[model samples]
Target: MSIPVAGRRQLNERHHRAALGLFLVVVIAHWAEHVMQAIQIYALGWPIPEARGVLGLAFPWLVTSEWMHYGYALVMLAGLIMLRAGFTGRSRTWWNIALGLQFWHHVEHLLLLLQALSGTNLAGRPVPTSVVQLLIPRVELHLFYNAVVFAPMVVAMLLHRRPREAERAVMRCDCALRTA
Candidate 1:
């Protein structure tokens, strides 16, 4: 049996919400890793190599590997671009802020990745580092970038869930929060 157009639209909205929820989980987990690393460095006083986040604990090289960082940046950029269509009004505004910041962060990572691929290091360092990283250091700069991107993205998600009536009316996805 064929579904009505309205039923299909609802089904699509549900799928979007489900996918968005999963994407949020991934984003939060990544943020957690950065937070954990910062804690290790500042509060715990662990050495940088020893504080290599969760995955890096098992694979220490992963923390220093330019490929991993570049891959994650690309993933973040793609996720932001892919999910942008569903946002509106205030949510869209906040999302654009996050997206704009992530775009620059992506550029930094791309620069580092290119240097690594070309066997070059920034400022004569042994490892490839971004231009900003030359001044901020890798671990700290990464934490800062993650915080800036994550903050606006969180605001966007919160606003999207409890949007203005006009925004809700235009939203294609059923991700809005319901009142009790």
Candidate 2:
């Protein structure tokens, strides 16, 4: 393909800020979840007062725990709107921020799924689906949670890849490079 002009790429600051803000929000949520989870872990293993539990919910989240994180997911989805804004000459940095947050979020989700599947939460609920319970009818709830929490991320990642190409194309347009 012929190289396009360099100046064709335009970044919209509004969109970029939005995407960046969203990414930061995701980062904060992940950090919060980890912090809360760690406190819970310590509480469960040792004797602590504040870590005793909050909201009357059981210690450590397995299934319903994810449903709680869905609020985090919605925040992420809203943040992706920055991409739409970015497309129309919005900020380029937002794309990178969004990408990083999406990746980290998925990684955490994977870890949590493995934890639940391994039977760490085995005492609390039935393994509704399981390799161990072919005869006993165990069910693995992680299957649903993983799909719900992480699917949009896969789609967003795919979408994020496109603008990167567009930006590259704009750079090749021979337009004066804007010093970021």
Candidate 3:
């Protein structure tokens, strides 16, 4: 059954901590994939084309598929938007910063997907290229993007878990640690 709008409210109110925990697991898994790819390329000296991440090793298409990349971007953006209401005060501010950065990251993935679909590489490149990829390589650019987005999210979560008196007063979820 489809959840009503009130379900989102409940998610922010009662189930926010659990939801946020699940979201963090997904984010960390994605990070692991990226790190594995970097290690394969830099440390193992694998050819760029062969340096697919862990899952990509079994399904090499994952590394080359613009759709998969774009789908991940969309998922990340949606998660950020959906979980935003759980944050307040400094946590909310930091969350908003991550949301904005992830929005741009999503846009870059969208551009890449569009280019791949239309068979028109950006700047006449052989493969799909994001805007930032014009200056930095794709692997490094994605690593940077993920790092920036994750950093602020970590800050938001930390602040959320230790909110001030005013913030705690307005919070609905029991995400903050209890004081004696």
Candidate lDDT values, in order:
0.86, 0.41, 0.95
Compare candidates 2 and 3 on TM-score and give the better one.
3
**What lDDT tens digits, residue by residue, belong to model 2 across residues 65-132?**
54454455445555553334443222334444554655454444444455555755433444222333
The CA-based lDDT of model 1 is what?
0.86
Judge candidate 1 at residue 167 and give its lDDT: 93
Whose TM-score is greatest here? 3
Candidate 3: how many backbone clashes?
0
TM-score preference between candidates 1 and 2, better one: 1
Top candidate, metric lDDT? 3
Q: For residue 88, give model 1's deviation from the true position in Å.
A: 0.7
Candidate 3 runs further than 4 Å off: 1-3
Runs of candidate 2 exceeding 4 Å displacement: 1-15, 39-66, 81-180
Clashing pairs in 1: none
| Clash pairs for candidate 3 | none
Candidate 3 residue 123 C-alpha distance from true site, Å: 0.8
Better of 2 and 3 by lDDT: 3
TM-scores of the candidates are 0.88, 0.34, 0.97
